[model samples]
Target: MSEITPDLVRHLGVLARIQLSDAEVERLTGQLDVIVDNIAKVSRVATPEVPATSHPIAMSNVFRPDVVGDMLTSEQVLQNAPDAADGRFRVTAILGEEQ
Candidate 1:
């Protein structure tokens, strides 16, 4: 098993440009050691016989197939607009932007 020491934590902090006190370095060392040990345990159990998977359960796409259907014409759609011009909907200028 790999060991996570305070010196290693301090070196990581330096690489990450983070300033960690002695107390923080000591605390992180213990936490990282636990994490590393747990990963090692998982590695031992995940053998060649067991297939690798991203999720615990099977997953698949649940969406319906895309199929083109009847669509309204541009004039038909613009008929309901409060204001339209040049075959398009016209709205007031926003954010002081030029047309």
Candidate 2:
């Protein structure tokens, strides 16, 4: 027995606010049945004994030790700015918005 029917497809179209013709309804009924059957088959194969995974292989994060480095002062960084104000870079207002 098929789980998807024309009436069910019509109801789904109505819920989704879609205007489906009779031909479309009939076509979708068969297509949706195949999709639902595939999902059921996959579900039956996914037993609790098998673990779920996002990837086929295990993964680990690599990290390096943090070290202090030479840095530029605020005044030295601001020297390259086209516009600066209040110790920060200033940009023109966008879309008539101001902060």
Candidate 3:
């Protein structure tokens, strides 16, 4: 397995805009080496024959019938509105420009 060098750590630190001390660089290098080795092992086992799947169980569309039900009157719809104007609920202006 290849070891992570101090140069590599320094380069990574620079790219990430992080300033690491000598001790931190040494510690990170060892950790990074182990991580890289583990990733390499995982990559070796990932083959083309293993088909990629998102879920373990089969799924199908579950839908309900689209049917229009009871409708509310205009008075019932605007009953809870704090402010109503011209037979509609009055809301604060959303756009900067006035309509």
Q: What does candidate 2's lDDT look like per residue over 1-99, in tens digits? A: 799999999999999999999999999999999999999998999999989999898987778779989999999999999999999999987765554
RMSD of each candidate?
A: 4.3, 3.3, 3.0
Error of 3 at 41 (Å): 1.5
What shift in Å separates residue 99 of candidate 2 from its native position after superposition?
A: 8.1
Per-model TM values vs. the true structure: 0.68, 0.70, 0.66
Instruction: Report the C-alpha lDDT of model 3 over 27-84, residue by residue, as the tens digit.
Output: 9999999999999987888789877667898888899889999999999989999999
Q: What ranges in model 2 sit over 4 Å off?
A: 62-72, 92-99
User: Is 1 or 3 the stronger prediction by TM-score?
Assistant: 1
Q: What shift in Å separates residue 11 of candidate 1 from its native position after superposition?
A: 0.5
Task: Return the number of clashes found in candidate 2.
Answer: 0
Cα-based lDDT for every prediction: 0.94, 0.94, 0.91
Instruction: Tell me model 2's lDDT, rounded to 2 decimals.
Output: 0.94
Which ranges of candidate 3 are over 4 A from the true structure? Answer: 57-73
